[model samples]
Target: MISVVLPARNAAATLPAALDSLAGQTLDDFEVVIVDDGSDDGGATRAVAAAFSGRDSRFRLLSRPHRGIVAALEAGIAAARGWAIARMDADDLCHPDRLLRQARHLDANPAVGLVSCQVAFGGDARAAQGYQTHIDWCNSLTSYQAIRLGIFRESPLPHPSVLFRRELIDRHGGYRAGDFPEDYELWLRWLEAGVVMDKLPQTLLTWNDPPGRLSRVDSRYHTEAFFRIKAGYLARFLARINPCHPRVIVAGAGRITRRRAERLLDHGIVIEAWLDIDPDKVGKRVAGRPVLPWDAVPGPEACFVLPYVACRGATEEILDRLQSRGFVLGQNCLPAA
Candidate 1:
């Protein structure tokens, strides 16, 4: 039987729907383990208990003192008994066939240790237009594409829609607290452990984007924090994959670019040049190196760092320009973490 773990912390407003969705899943061989994380209102817990009361023997609820999401998830992981462990957010809706499809996929593909499906951004009883682009981007991600693109970069497969083989999670020692970018950290750890993950080509969850969400409320969700984590992980990965240092070009003069360059420099990686598009920053010096204009950038064999997440569009444009100039990724230009 599949074990679905839902960790809740005062998610009263949206918890019931999630349970209801699970109740309707086509795969009836699954059990729900809801870990109530010290809910002050107690309403979310009661609602959850009431929703599953007397229905199925697979539904179980456990209460734990408020520790945080990571801790709560760790608790759920410890309590899970199924060979396959699936995660569902307290405020998200799962498609009726979500478990069946993912379980079938995992059963069919033993080489894949983890499986995640595309999700639609819909909530407030309706869909959001802004998520169309994100949804499409998520759906287009292939396993290899995810690997080369830096699993943590470009939105590594969504966490809520993922299913993990319990054995793999156990081998990795489960989740850890203070993992700033928790989801990314876990995915990267799996990758580092030589675990393969893939995305199912169907929308299986509906993500709810609400006002005052945890990300919007917490500094832990800040862009800089995520960027730092991703960069650190990438740097570590690169060091392992390519021990020999290559000439690296710091691709932006912004704060992020400079920060990343400094981190790489700390690792004794040589910085060949700083490339920037802004005329003002083009000739300026950062970290004792002159900033060169984008056009006057160094050879493609030199690694490039487009450190600023905000400059993603511009980064893509620059990559296009580099490709047009016959500098392809993994060959001519590699990402400098």
Candidate 2:
């Protein structure tokens, strides 16, 4: 059985659609554990969940005070009875075959701890272009190695689309409450603990990208917090791979990019130099490190290269260039954007 954990807070407006999608799933052997995280909608959210519970015996609702998503998710997980726990947000829609496909994949690949399917963005097209790009980039990383290599660059899997093994969460002590985004933090923690994860190529979920989403409003999901989280994980990963603490070369020279990279420096990771494609920026100094042209990048034996570039095509170009130079990815050159 697959337990679908749906955490809702002030989600009365969207809960029905989400619940309806779950009720319509092709896979019938599943339970929905809906945790109402203190919705102040005058019991409207509870009414909706209660209505679903009345109609579908598989749907269960749990009420709790406003303790945020981390706590709510934990509550749902604790109440879940399935071997695999699938996540569903109140504002998103799941494809009918999502659970069936994901569960089958897990049944076939027992070694994978977590798996997420590609997502389709459902909102204003103008505001969703960035999200669409993110979805596309994330979907490109379909293998465990690709996901691991790009984990620091971004959240390799969509949180709501994920189906996780119960043992995986239990082994890691469950979701952690922190000043950073919980989902990203969990992924980082799992990756740090050597948990194997992958993504399904099919888009089995529709992600709602509304303006008032938690990620947009919560300070904990801000850019700086993400950077700090990335830096912490990157430092640990680099130390494990290169115990000698080689001076690392950064691949972007922009001030904001450099500032983010500075977090790693604070963790005692030395910066050997910076690399950039700009002719004017070349031969200049950034944060006391010389900015060199692409051709001047140090060989794999000398130092490790980290790409901090965020441009559309630049990351692929950088990866190709590094690979062409015989610097194996995830070994000597890792993308850290």
Candidate 3:
């Protein structure tokens, strides 16, 4: 059986549609565990869940006080019965075959600890361009190695579209509560622990981008928090890959990128050089590191390269240059955002 964990908090506006989608799934061997995290919308959220539970025996609702998402998720996970724990949000809609496909993939590929799928973003037509770009970038990472290489660049998998083995979560101590995005932190932790993760190429979820989403309002998902998380994990990953404590070369000479790279210094990562295409910044020293031209970047035998630029097109160009120079991704070079 597959246990679907749906966390809700004042999600009355879109909870019904989400539950309805689950009810319409092609797979029948699944249970939905809805954790109502203190929704105060006149008990509307509870009413929705109650109605669904009455209609479908597989649906169950667990009401709790106003605890955060981490607590709600932990409660739901503890109550789950299936070996495979699938995640769902109160506002997202899953495709009819999402459960069947994901469960089958896990059954066939026992080595894969977690699997996510492509997502279709809904709401706000004006903001579609940015969301589309992100979706495209995420879809490009279809293999385990590709996902790991791009993990630090961004959240390579959509949280709501993922289905993972319960054992993996148990071994990692479950979701961690901190001053950073919980989903990203969990993925980073799993990667650090050598957990194999991959994403399906097909879009299996409709992700709603409402203005009041937690990511927009919560300080934990802020830009600085993401950078801090990335720097911490990147430093540890680099250290593990390079036992000799080789100097790290950061690509990009912008102030913002430099600021993010500087955070790595606090983690004991030595930033020995910076690679840039700009002639003005070349030969100059920034943050005690000399900014060198692209041709001057150290080879794989010397230092590890991290592409710190955020521009997607420019990042691809930088990656091409690194690859041409015989730098292997996830080894001597890793892309960063």
Candidate 4:
């Protein structure tokens, strides 16, 4: 059986549609754990969930105090009774085949611990171009290697699109509440612990970007928060993979890139030099380190490199240049935004 853990607070307006999709899923052997997170909508959320529970025996409702999403999700997952736990949200829609395909993949691939499906952006792409672009990039990473290599760059897995084995939680623990986005932190933590996570090629979920979505309203999901959380983990990952434990050549010399690089530096990782193709920045000193031209990049034997460029298409170009010089990713070069 597959247990769908969904948590929502004051989401009565969107609950019915989400419930309808789940009730209509092609997979019959599944349960939906609806967590009503102390809804403030005059018990509307509870009413909606209760109505669903009354109509469909597969749907179950759990009420909890408004402690936030992490607490609510943890509660729901704890109450779940399936070996496989799939995540859902109160506002997103799912394809009828989502659970069957994901469950079958897990049953067939014993080694893959976690799997997420490609997601369609449910918002207006033009209005929410950045969000849509991010989703598109995430969908491109369909293999375990691609997901692992790009893990530090951004969240490669859409949270609600994921269906993971329950043992993952038993072995690696569950969503952590901290100064960061919980899902991103969990993925990084699991990957660091050698958990293999990948994505399904099929887009089986529609990721909605509601006006009050947690990512937009919560400071814990902000840019600096993400960088802070990724830095310490990236530092450890580089230590494990790169022969030169804490020393790396950073790929960009711009202000924001320098700040991001500093996060790793804060974790004791040293920048041997900086890399930039621009002639003006070349032969210059940035934060006491020389900004070397791309051609001056040290060979894989000499140093591991981190391409911290965030500009669109720039990081990919830098990665291509590095690979052309025979630097294997996760061995000598790790690209980050």
Candidate 5:
């Protein structure tokens, strides 16, 4: 049997559609674990969850006090009985075949620890450009190697579109409560622990971009928070992958780049040199590390390289240059954008 862990807050307005889609799933041998996360909306959230549980024996409601998403998710996860546990947001809708396809893929492929299907951006594409672009980028990482290469770029997997094995949680642990995006942090942690996550090319869920999405309201999803958590994980990754452990050439020397890359220093990652195209910055020192011209960057043999830039398309351009000089991404050259 399969288990779907649905976590909800005061999501009364959008809860029904999410439930209806679950009830209409093509896969019948599945249970929906609806977690009412202390919704204070006049009991509307509980009423809606109770109504669904009343009609469908497959739907189980775990009424709990108002904790945070991490606590609610843990409650539902503990209650889940299936070998494979899937995730669903209270505001997102799943395709009828979402569970069936993901479970089958997992059944056929024993090597993959987690599997996420492509997701449709269920919002105005034109109005929500940044979110839409992020969704598109997440979809582009369809292979295990691509997921590893793009993991630091952003969350390569959409939270609501994934179905992972309970074994992964048993071994690596589950959603962590911290000052960061829980899903992204989990992915980074698991990936660091050698979990092999892959993606199905087919789109099987609607990743809605509602105005009141948690990422929009929560400080945990802020840019600085993400970078903070990323620095620790990225530092580990560099140490493990690079022959020159703890030593790297930073590929950007701008103020924002230096500020963000400085986080790695706390992890004992030494900056061998800073590569910059600017004449003024080339001879200057950032964090007491010399900034050199980009064309004079050391080869992958000399030291590992981290392309630390967040400009819209600067990372790709930097990677192209690095690859041209025998530096490989997810290998000697890792990106930190």
Candidate 6:
């Protein structure tokens, strides 16, 4: 059986929608565990209560003080009785077949310790904040490629989309709070411990993009903490993947990419070149590498592309062009150095 965990805090406005989606799921062999974090809005608790009122024994609610998301998720994980644990967010909605599909994938591929699926933007779909592009870019990655390309670093597997083995969490100890990012840290641990993770080729989750969310209310989600968390793991993984110091090429000569190039150069990885499609940046130099036009670069046999930003369309377009010229990604190319 599958156990679905939803950790909520002041999610009254969106909680009902989240629970409704789960209630409509085609798979009924799963249980719902909602951990209510200390919520001033009180919507989370109300939503949980409504979801369980006169319902079957499958739904369970656990309440706790506002000790942050890690603590809440820990409570839900501890209460979960199933061998497989799936994650759902307080505000996001799951597809009707999400659990069924994820469970089947895990059962069929025993080697996979965790699985996630494609997610589309909900709430407000017209926001030009790159949601459409993000969906397109995220869906392009295969299950193996997502895990191999340092998935946590280059736009994580989308936390709400994951359904992983409970044993994996027990062995590593469920989510921890503080300076480290929870999901990214867990993904790193899975990689370090050699736990395989896969992604299904279908969209199974809908991300609710609402105004005044925690990510926007509190800047923690967009802070330097995630960067540090990602960078540490990326360094360790890259060192393992390219022991001999592979030839590196960085795209987008921006501040972020320039800093990344500096970090690699400091670590003795030869910078093959810097690239940019902007005419103004085409002839400049950054971190001692000549900034060349995108098409001027040599093959990946002698270089790996490390684009700075997650400009999904631009990145994929460049990747396709480079890939067509016999560049195998992960082995020869990487994203966001």
Per-candidate TM-scores read 0.89, 0.95, 0.95, 0.97, 0.97, 0.84
Candidate 1 lDDT, 116-182, residue by residue in tens: 8888877443354434555566667766545545454445576789998999865886776663657
lDDT for 231 in candidate 2 is 90
The 10-residue segment of model 1 with minimum total lDDT is: 303-312
Q: Higher lDDT: candidate 4 or 6?
A: 4
How well is each residue in 1-337 modelled by candidate 3, as lDDT tens digits?
A: 9999999999989999999999999999999999999988899999999989988899999999988999999999999999999999999999999999999999999999999988887766566677678877888889999998888888898889999999997698689898998999999999999999978877899988877878878999887888888888888888887633647888998998999888988889888888998888899997787999977776777778888988768788898999998988877888888
- Runs in model 2 deviating more than 4 A are 242-244
lDDT string for model 4 (226-299, tens) is 88999989988888898987889999998899998899888889898989877888999988999998778778
Best by lDDT: 4
Candidate 2, 94: how far from true, in Å? 0.9
Candidate 3, pairs of clashing residues: none
TM-score of 1: 0.89
Query: Which portions of model 1 show Cα errors greater than 4 Å?
Result: 123-136, 152-154, 240-246, 302-309, 332-337
In candidate 6, stretches whose alpha carbon ends up further than 4 angstroms from where it belongs are 42-44, 47-54, 150-153, 223-226, 243-247, 260-273, 277-285, 288-299
**Backbone clashes in model 3:** 0
Model 5 TM: 0.97
User: Clashing residue pairs, candidate 6?
Assistant: none
Cα error of candidate 6 at position 28, Å: 3.0
Number of clashing pairs per prediction, in order: 1, 0, 0, 0, 0, 0
Candidate 6, residues 190-256: lDDT per residue as tens digits? 7777888888888899987677655545545664556556665665666666533545677777776
Task: Report the lDDT tens digits of candidate 5 across residue range 233-273.
Answer: 98888878889988888888888888889899999998888
Candidate 2, residues 1-337, lDDT tens digits: the string is: 9999999998999999999999999998999999999999999999999999998999999999999999999999999999999999999999999999999999999888888988888877676777778878888888999988888887878889999999987688778888888999999999889888978888899999877789889998887888888897898888877633647888899888899888897788998889998888899887788999978887778778888887777878988998898988878888888
lDDT of 4: 0.93
